[model samples]
Target: MLASPRPIPSQRLSRLWYLGRATGDLAAGLGFKGLIELAQSQAQDRPARIQISPEHARRFAERLSELRGAVMKLGQLMSMDGTDILTPEVAEVLAGLRERATPMPMSQLVEVLTREYGRDWDRRFKRFEFTPVAAASIGQVHRAETHDGHRLALKIQFPGVRASIDSDIANLGLIVRTLGLGPKGIDIRPFLDEARRQLHREADYEAEAKALERYRACLGDDPDLAVPQVHRDLTTPNILAMDLATGVPIDRLAGPEYRRAERDRAATLLMRLTLRELFEFGLVQTDPNFANYLYDRTSGRIVLLDFGAMVPIAPSLITCYRQLARAIIAGDRAGIQAAAIALGYVGAADPQDQVAAMLDLLELAAEPLRSPGVYDFGASDLFERVYRQGRALFHAGVFSAAPAPETMFLHRKFMGSFMLARRLRARVELAQLVPLCL
Candidate 1:
């Protein structure tokens, strides 16, 4: 058995640790900046390929993975949106968090299982594996079997993760502010506060179990989808137990061996699910890590996993988004801006030029929907164009407010699905899906 992790730092102590790490990063960044300036002065006409040392980024990621709560979740969020804003080295390193996170040692796993069940917990299972099958920012999952021949997946929360949420959130805010990862004018406090709230919800396994049951109820009849059945007897606030569903990670289908038509069908199914989550169910699983989806080839079903990040949609916001979708389909920029203002994306007092720029960016994002037929995500330049324009707008100090909590997660879920569609080179007729949802 491996040694357990050193206990995560508490509220007061973690703040100091985060500060120290931030200071180190600041020094490294300044050093890199100075080197760039010196190189520019020496080579007046030549362009330079600028990158930070890989070690700086690696160390940063390692520290957050070790902490494993709000800090790691924040890293996951940054990695999701970091391509345009972060240096290549930093972005590459943070991207690792999206993969299976570091798992707890066998010893720590024993302690948690013992705490949740009794020290004689082995009696409850016919067989239980000490090694984890998957791990993430909040927990690690292991395989188990009951005496009645039921196989199960047990998601065990890290011992201290829930306790450390508030501190990790505060520490992350300090680190981001000190490093200035976003535009200077943007106030990310609302985002940070929302992250804190969501973290609390995610850390609660009991709540996640209820969400799983709710989703099963709503989506159970769908022939192309699968949701695991929760094992309530084995479940607790710190541990979630569900029937083990066999499947390959959805990303595996992105390879050349899969037929283009099959890939397109998969993407379309996911898009339809997103529409249902928004307009029909009003509930969404916001974390977009591709690993959360699995392809059960035998059944041709998309297996949904991990409901910890599920969130309910606001009804009013859905109406606003419906209007925005209609405006995008009609190519009405003014209508788009009006809907955006309704959704709190802009203000009445903003200058017309600034609002127009924002509307243009929104329209660009809607490129896939504007097409009357299939949208070729693989060949599209919309993502790149949007990044370039959004960055330019940010540099111009056009954006001030952080997105509302509902909008932020909704955007994450939708954008994440789009990125996956592109990865699979999946073509979809998104315009048709939009109306069905409305």
Candidate 2:
């Protein structure tokens, strides 16, 4: 079994030590220059295979978990953005950051409880589990029962994570640049700054509680979805309490026993919700981690969790995105180009062939929306096609500007949702669903 991460390093120097250790460990593996050369010479039919040793993966994960703030979040970001660039072995190791990290020891938990709820905090709960049920970068959640016998989940923020956010992010940026993990010619500074801002909001439990409530209201009367109700009396800036919502993890449906209809229903509901979030609610929980979604088999509803990454979308951007989709459906290249430029996806100076390739990639991705009915994700080769185009574009050095954080995050959510659908081999009437959003 993988070892649970040790205590988080709250002090600046302590955190810096953990990062330095991780960078050194990664450096011991295949160097970044080696990776860049391998990628260049890699064959299209059979890509060169290189893997980080298991020891390095474990070591990297451990240090990130120990740091448990912006550093850990950076690991998750690398896992997501490095899919095409990083070797699979390395990506697999980084992907583990998405799951629970080691929980804070009982002493630490008690200290937080005492700080938040006072000396008589034990009296408030009929029973509380000392061990956390789930742990993440900013906090870990415990299961508890109120004196009134109400079952609840308590989210306790790691001490000092909020204060350490800025420094941790700065340290993380330094480590990334030093390792040359970033792709050539792409300025990652805006995205890094955006991440710091987002992490600050996530560390604020009070803000998360409000976003949860707003999201619940936004998803009102949606029979297919469920959001936990916040217990305001028990909530504080560092703590959040809500009903103990129960369900199986959504990924369980990946099993062979799950029928096509059941899988399709889940995917369609998720896609529909995504559209509503973008076009109707104008707000979204941008992190689409499978663990954040639970399937209530009895209720047939998807239980939504983790409101920390929730963000608002600009109305004009949504308009541009919708226009882009409409143009794809209509085969209007000019309209597509106009919308792409408006959305900051293509630069005005990008070469015509490169722009054409980008447009082709966009059109391929939009195929589901353009289909009349039952777009089969199981049989689709769209991902491979898009990957090929994206690889070529990345090497051509024609794309310079990174999309705004808002657009990038929205795309992240969309792509993740689609990936889940593909994993379940879902068949969705996506064309029909697009109309509901408009």
- Say which candidate scores most in TM-score: 2
Query: Distance (Å) between predicted and true CA of 121, model 2?
Result: 1.3
Per-residue alpha-carbon lDDT of candidate 1 for residues 1-438, written as tens digits (9 for 90 to 100):
222344545565864576467447635753767567545733442223335556776666666676677667766776664544457677767777765566777678889989999989999999999877777789988999999999999999988889888877776677678756545776788887887888899999999999999988988688899899999999999999999988877767877878888889999999999989888887899988777889988888989998998998888888888899988888887789889889877787888888888888888888888788999887887776776688677766678755576578888899988887886788999989888887
- What TM-score, computed on C-alpha atoms, does each candidate reach? 0.88, 0.90
* Candidate 1, superposed: residue stretches over 4 Å from native: 1-59, 78-96
Best model number under lDDT? 2
Please list all clashing residue pairs in model 1, or write none if there are none: none
Q: What is each predicted model's overall lDDT from 0 to 1?
A: 0.79, 0.81
Q: lDDT tens digits, residues 1-438, model 2?
A: 234536667888888998899877766665686566566644452233445675787688777887788788767655653335566677667767776676777778888999999999998989998778788888988899988888999999998889999888788788779867676888888887887888888989999999999999999978889999999999999999998988866766867867777789998999999999988999988886777888887888889999998999888998998898788888899999989989888888888887787888788888898888799987886776776667667777656766676676788788878777876778999999887787
Candidate 1 Cα deviation (angstroms), residue 347? 1.3
